[model samples]
Target: MDGSITGHRPRAAAPVGADGLAARRGEAVERAALPAARRPGTAGSESDTPAANALDGMPRQRTARAAAATPTALSAGTVANATAPVPSALSADPAAASGAPAPSAAPARARRPGSPAARAAQAVGRLLPTPFGTPFTFGYALVLTVTSYVAGHADPAVVRALHQASSTDVAHLVRYPVAVLFASALWIVGGILSPYAAGFLLVLTALERRIGGVRAAGVFLLGHVVATLATEVPVGLAVWAGHLPGSSLHRFDYGISFGVAASVGALAGLLSPWLRWPLLALFGSVLAEGLILLDDPMTNWGHLLALALGVATWPLVRRAARARAAAPTAAAA
Candidate 1:
């Protein structure tokens, strides 16, 4: 060998064990397979490993699909819940849940007979009896028509005698108290035609319904007797005082006008405000006219007096009605 080192010569050095050689080879293969970014001591290389990348990519792909499908599924569930009816069993009533009877299952308390409901029922029942549900009213009209017809056909002497007997004069009151009953209802002028039949039917029937037949009759009689006495007494006193001729005692006076006026007055109390006011106004105007005109002094005065008596009877009428309403309830108890 020349000392000038003309050719580079290989030098055989230390020999390695089999185990060490195999370990070195395995390390080299692992390093070659790894990416540069994943090599040790590289920034963020811990997260860039193939196993970590695969784990992260698998979850992200699955989550994206889940998110996209979630809104559609949520919307469908919401619509289903909104449109679906709740089951009756699920909507339990508090009472039923507590083992108590439901309100609909419980028996209703019995109503007292005199209660407003009972009165209404009774009134309905009464209404079913007649067209206007007032038999007395019809009877009165029938009687008037028959009597009028009889008077029309009777002899002149007999008709005159009937008029005399039926006169409501103060001179006849003491001796013929019975005359008071018949006198006030008789029509002396045109017979039944002198009185308004329609007015009588309507007024009397309405009064009877509102205050019952008994009270209605009381009101009529009270008006008739009081008005007649009131008018006749003044005339009697005037005649005795010589202010008028004695002929005033025999003044022919007979009609149902006074009773009609009183009935209207009593009805005013029972009527609602709307009807009451108009009725009072109308009656008041008529009375005022009579007073101003002074055409038939006695009759006008009787009408006015009768109206006053009717107004006075309001307390009694109201009390009776209340008692009637309460009677059924009291009886039930």
Candidate 2:
């Protein structure tokens, strides 16, 4: 009987109190001393990956599919960094933007009539648009205002000479096209209180707010130049053909009415359909009524032409309005 009792009760069990605690504590100490790679969450885990399994003599080909499906830490990280979403407000409310007032950040209060916003809304025309954004209006209006005062006080002869020099008459345009074309727009022939002057201030400011200063200026200039040529060219042609008298070439033709008409037309494009049609009808009625007496048929016809030209710019002004609306806050400018 070569028998050695198989296991003599598996060495007496460790005591619950002293030796057991010491042994468990030592095991933890040994584990803590091991290198990081051998620790949980460290690299080179004995995973089911082919690369890891290859160490145990599996085929290298075994890892191809796994490698593709589960990106390695290094490659996956490269992709993650490249594809990470940019940080954003993650909010749909417009109040979250930098320039906008954040919701619930301020105490709840009623809007007061005395507040700056309310006062700004109530400001009269000409000053309606903020100066910084509407440079064309600011500089041009200042120049016009000064000129109006000078022209009112200057000798009759001098005022006549200046207007003659700036008039888009056939003779002046032939002699100095650039000078008269630009100078003609720099006056309010009826003074600043004229209906056309008021129209200029109101229409242009509204236009500047919607489509910006540059665009407003463009619309105005387009109208002024087109209408001037339209009305003057016919006279020039008639004179050359001996139909109009030579005195027709010296005809006085200057005003901001053309530009105002155009701005009104462009502004109409940015209005709602309800407002658009009414505005056109009212403006058209005023223009048509101006011809009832037929005292200045050519001039009245030019006004109608300029207004039509403005109405034609609907597509352009609408695009600008849409662009401004896309901004988080398109203040005046």
Highest TM-score model number:
2
Across residues 13-51, which tens digit of lDDT does each residue of candidate 1 receive?
457789877886566444433444654323466654566
User: Looking at model 1, how many pairs of residues clash?
Assistant: 3
- Cα lDDT of model 2 by residue, 1-333, tens digit: 578776557465445677767775555444344444553223564444545644532222313344345433235456767754334476666554443555576787876568787667677533554578677776777888887887898998999988888899999989999889999887897887788876776778888988888899999999999998999999999999999999999988887888888888989988899999999999999999988879777888888999999999999899988897777465645
Clashes of each: 3, 0
On the 0 to 100 scale, the lDDT of residue 171 in model 1 is 78
> What TM-score does structure 1 among the candidates reach?
0.57
Can you tell me which runs of candidate 1 are displaced by over 4 Å?
Answer: 1-135, 186-189, 194-196, 326-333
Model 1 clash pairs are 113-329, 114-328, 114-329
Candidate 1: residue 303 Cα off by (Å):
0.1
Provide the lDDT at 51 for model 2: 55
Candidate 2, residue 228: Cα displacement in angstroms equals 0.4
Q: lDDT at 189 for candidate 1?
A: 54
